[model samples]
Target chain A: MEAFTQHTGKIVPLDRANVDTDQIIPKQFLKRVERTGFGQYLFYNWRFDTQGNPDPDFELNQEKYADGSILLSGANFGCGSSREHAPWALLDYGFRVVIAPSFADIFYNNCFKNGILPIRLPEETVNTLFQRVAQEITHTLTVDLEANKMEDHNGFSAEFKVEPYRRYCLLNGLDDIAVTLQKADKISSYEKNLPSYYQVQEKQNL
Target chain B: MKPRTLFEKVWDRHVIDQEEGKPATLYIDLHLVHEVTSPQAFEGLRLNGRKVRRPDLTVATMDHNVPTTNRNLPITDETSAKQMNTLAKNCKEFGIRLYDLDDPGQGIVHVIGPELGLTLPGKTIVCGDSHTSTHGAFGALAFGIGTSEVEHVLATQCLQQLKPQTMEVHVKGTLSPGVTAKDVILAIISEIGTDGATGTVIEYTGEAIRNMSMEERMTVCNMSIEAGARAGMVAPDETTFRYLENRTFVPKGEAFEQAKQLWRQLQTDEGASYDKRVVLDASNIAPQVTWGTSPGMGSAVTDRVPDPDSFQSDAERKSARRALEYMGLKPGTPMSEIPVDRVFIGSCTNSRLEDLRMAAQVVKHRKVAPGVRAMVVPGSQEVKKQAEAEGLHEIFLHAGFEWRESGCSMCLAMNDDVLSEGERCASTSNRNFEGRQGRGGRTHLVSPMMAAAAAVHGHFVDIRNWTFKD
Candidate 1:
C-alpha cells in the first residue's frame, strides 16, 4: 500500500450510476492469481467490442482521458459484488482518486486497503465535475488527502469527509493486516481462553 | 444499558479488540469460501507465510465456475479448471475442510453454510461472496468481504470491520399465495433504491418475515447486497432451530438445548431504534420482476415498464433510459408482453429444494413454451438428489426443461450455461446487472415460481393468474 498524498491528474468522467464491480473487472478476467495486470482487462466488456478492439465511445478510450488518474463517476460507483478485484483493476489502471456521490460499502473499504483514495462528494458536486470534464476534456483535479480537499483547474474547490481512522491509515499506508498484527498479544490471549460455547476443533489448533 | 438491536448484540459480542478510531477486530465464527474468490486469498496467505489461523472454522467449496452440465466429464475451460484445482490444492495444504465437486454437501457457499448447520445463530460469519448474508437468517451477523479481507480472516480468524449503522425493515401483513420471499425482497429493493441501505445493516422484522420458513428467510436475506446493505438478518426462531436440528454440524443432546435457549433470545430488544426504518405491506407485494439492469428497476407483474421521463432525477432518468435500451423494452409495454428467450431457476438466491419444489409445482404437467429454453440447476448435489427422489427432476425434464447438476450455473455465466447475445432470460438470481448472465444478456430477476411461469408462458406472468395443473 502506498501513502496517498496530493496528486493532480486528468479527470475521467464515467457518467453512469450503480457502476458495479462486475463491470469494473468482469468475471472472465478474474481467473488470474496475481492482482496486477488487471488494468488491461478493466471494464473489458464496455471498453472492448465483440471483435476485441477498443471501443471508441468509452470515455477512457478517448485521447484526453487516456491518462486519467482521477475518476469522476455518478452515485453508487461500486455497487454489486464484494470483489476487491474492482479496486485492484482501478488502481492498476492508474486511478488514484475516485470521486462519486456515494459508493458501495465493500468497494469503498477495499479502495482504502489498496491505496486508492475514494472521495464521496454531494451528487450535485459530482454532476458538476462531470459537466466540467465534458466541457473541457483537459480538466484536471488535485486531491490532497492530508487536507481532505479537491481543487480543479478552474478554481473550483471543495472539501470532502474521511473517517478519521481511515484517513490515518491512508496517510500512513497502514493496511488492516498490519494494524491487526500489532495487537498480536491481545488476539493470542483471547484465543487461549476461548469460551466453551465458542466451538473450536482443538485437534487442529495451530 | 441500551435496548440493542440483534445486530448490535451479535456484533458487540464478537469484537475481540477495538481501538478508539480504527475498525474493530471482530472474531469470525465461520468463514465460507468458493472457487472464484479464494484462490487469490490463499495465494496472499502463502506470500505472507501465514497458515490459516482457524482451519476448522473456515470451509471451502467449488462453485461459480463449475459446469452445471456434464459433471462426469473433465472441465474443458482451462481457467475454470485451474481455479477449481487451485482451491482443492490450497484447501488440502491449509488443512481446511472442503466440499469438493463430488461432495454431496457441496453447493453454493451460502446454501451449504446453513444446510450443514455451520452457520449458527448469534455467531459472526464472513464470506468472499456477497450473498453470505443468507446465513444471517439464523440470527448470525453475516456480511460479504473482499478477497483481501478474506485473506485477513484466513490468517487471523478475525476481520477489521467498521460497525455499520442498523436499519429495520418491518413488513406487516401476510404474503398472498403465489407471492414468495423473492417477491418480498424485490419489493423492498424497489421501495428503497439500490443504494437505499448504503452503510447500514438491515434487520428484517414484522409478521410477514416471521411467517416464512427458514429457506424462505434465506431467500430474503440472500439479496440484501442488491439493496446496497452490508448484510441483512432475520431473528432466529423455532423455524430456524427446527431447520438446524439434526444437521451434520449442529450440536446435539444437551448442547442443542443450551444453544436453542441462546438463539431464542436473538431479537431486537423492546423499544430499540434503528438508524432507518422502512415499512411495507407484504400483502400488497405481488409477483415481481425487474425490467432494467438494476434490481431496483422492478415492478409488479401487472405493471408496465416505467417511463424514464417520469423519473424526477436526471441520473435516475438516464439510468432508466439506458436500462430500457439494454432490455429492449418500451416504457408502457406490459411486463407480461415482454418475451423471454430462456428461464433459469438456480443460484444462491433461489436454488434450494424449497425453491425447486415451488418451480416444480408450476411445471408439474405443463410443457415449456415453444422456442424458450428452460433449465433447473439445483444448488447442490444434495438438493439435486432430494429433488430427484421427490420426482421433481422428472417433472422438469418431462416439461421440456433441462435438469442439470448443481453449481453456480448461469447465475454468473462463468460456466457453460449462459445467455447468448440479445437473449432475454427470466432468472431466479440476485443480480440483473448488465451482462451478468453473459455478454449482451438481459436478465429479468424473478422468483422460482415466476421463472417457471415465464418458461411455460414464454413471457413474464403473474403466478397468481397461472393455474397449476398439479
Candidate 2:
C-alpha cells in the first residue's frame, strides 16, 4: 500500500455513474493473480468495438480528456457487486482520486485499501466539477489527502471526511494486519497466558 | 448497555479478546474461499514464509473464473488454468479440503456451504467474496473480507471486528400472487435508500419471514449486502433444522436434539428494543426491475422512469438524474418499453433449483425471440444435474435458450461468456452497474421468470399474464 499525502495530478473525467467493478476491469482480465498490468485491460470491452477497433465515441477515447489522472464521476459510482479489481484497475490506470457524489460501500473501502482516494462530495460540488471539466477540458483538480480537501485551480474547493482510523491507515500505508502486528509482543504474551486462563474458567464453571 | 439480541449474543460468545480503541478479536468458526480472490492471499502467505494455521477450519472451491460451457480440468484460457492450479496447490500445501471442478459437491461457495451443512447457525463465517451473507440466512454471522483479512483469519482463526449497531426490519402481512423473496428484498432496498442499512446488522423478523423456506430466506439475506448492511439474519427455526437434517456437517441424533433446543431461543423478546426499527408491508410490493445502475434505482415493470424534478430533495433529484443518464434511459419512458437483447438467469442470487423451475415454467411453451440470446447457467453442478434429471434443461433447450454448465457465468463476466458491447440484457444477478455485464452492455436486474419473459419477448416484459400455477 502506498502512503497517502497531498497528490496533484492531471484531471481525467469519467462522467458516467454506476461504474461497476466488472466494467472497471472485466472478468476476463481477472485471470492474473498479480495485480499489476490490469491497467491495460481496464474498460477493455468499452474501449473497443466488436471489430476490435477503438470506439472513438467512448469517453476515454476523446483527445480532450487524455492524460487526466483524476476521475470526476456522477453519483453511485462503483455500485455493483463487490470486486476489489475495480479499484486496482482504477489505480493502475493512473487515477489517484475518484470524486463522486456518492459511492458504493464496498467499492469505497476497496479504494482506500488500494491507495486510491475516493472522495464523496455533495451533489452540487460534483455538478460544478462536471461543468468545469466540460467548460475547460484542460482544467486540473488537486487533492490533499493529509488535509482531506480537494480543490481546483478555479477557486472551487471542498472538504471530504473519512473515519479517523481509516485516515490514519491510509496516511501511513498501514492495513489492519500491519496495525495488529505492531502489537506482536502483547499478542505473544496473551497467547502464552491463554491456556491457564481458560483452565481457570473451566474450573469455575465446574 | 442494552439487552442482547441473537446477534449480540453470538458476537459476545465469539470474542476472544478486546484491545482498547481497536477492533475486538473474535474467533471464526469457518473460512470459505473461491478461485477469484484466494490466489493472491495464498501468494502473500508464501512470500512471507507463513503457513495456513488452521486448515481444518478452511475450505476452498472454484467459481468466478470457471467457464460454464466447459467442465474440463485444464480450462481453455491459460490465465484461468493457472488460477485453478494455484488454488489446488495452495489447498494441498495447507491440508485444506477443496471441491474442485466436476466434484459432486462443487457449486457456488454460498450455495455449497449450506447444501453440505458446512454453514451452521451461530458460527462466524468469512469468505473473500461478497454475498457471503447468504449464509446468514441460517442465523450465522457471515461477511466478505479482503485478501489481507483472509490471511489474518487463516493464520489465527480469528478476525478483528468492530461491533455493529443492530436494526430490526419487520415485514407484516402476506405477499401477493407472483411475489417472491427477490421482490421483497428489492422493494426493501428501494424503500430505504441503498445505504439506509449501512453500519448496522439487520435482523429480519415478521410473519412473512417465518413462512419462507430456507432457500427463500437465503435469497432474501443474500441481497442484504446490497442494502449496505454488514449482514442480514433470520432466527433459526424448525424450517432451518429441517433443511440441515441430512447434511454432512450437521449434528446427528442426540447432539442434533440438543442443538435444536438451543436454536429455538434465538429470537428477540417481545419487549426487546432495537437501535432502529423499520416496518414494511409485503402487500404493496410488485415484481420489480432495476432500470438504472444501482439496485435501489428500481420500479415496478409497469412503471416509467421518473423525472428528476419530481424528486422533493435536490440530492434525490441529482441521484435520479445521474442514474437515468448513465443508464441511457429516457425520463417518462415506461420500463416495459426498454428492449433487451439478451437474458441471463443464473447467479448466487437466484440460481437454485427453484429459480430454474420458475424460469422453465415461463418458457415451457414459448420460443425465445429471434434476436434474443438467452442462457441459463445453474449455480452448481449439483443444481445443473438435478435440473437435468427433472427435464428442466430440455424445457429450456426447446425454448431456444442455451443451457450451460455451472459457474458465475455472465453474472460478472469473469469467464468467456459475456454480453456484446451496446447490447441490453435482463439479468437475474444482482447489480446493474454501467457496463457490469460487458463494456457498454446495459443491464436491467430482474427476477428469473422476468428474465425468461424478456428472453421470449426480446424486451422487458411483464410475466403476470404468463403465470402458471405452481
lDDT of 2 by residue, B273-371 (tens): 778889998887788889876788888888998788998876677667877776778989988888888899998898999999989998887899999
CA lDDT of A176 in candidate 2? 64
User: What's the DockQ for every one of the candidates?
Assistant: 0.54, 0.21
* Worst lDDT 10-window in candidate 2 chain B: B461-470
Q: Relative to the unseen true structure, what is the C-alpha lDDT of residue B133 in candidate 1, on a scale of 0 to 100? A: 84
Flag regions of model 1 displaced more than 4 Å. A192-206
Off by over 4 Å in 2: A13-17, A43-72, A121-160, A178-206, B72-74, B269-275, B305-339, B365-371, B456-461, B467-470
Cα lDDT, all candidates: 0.89, 0.79
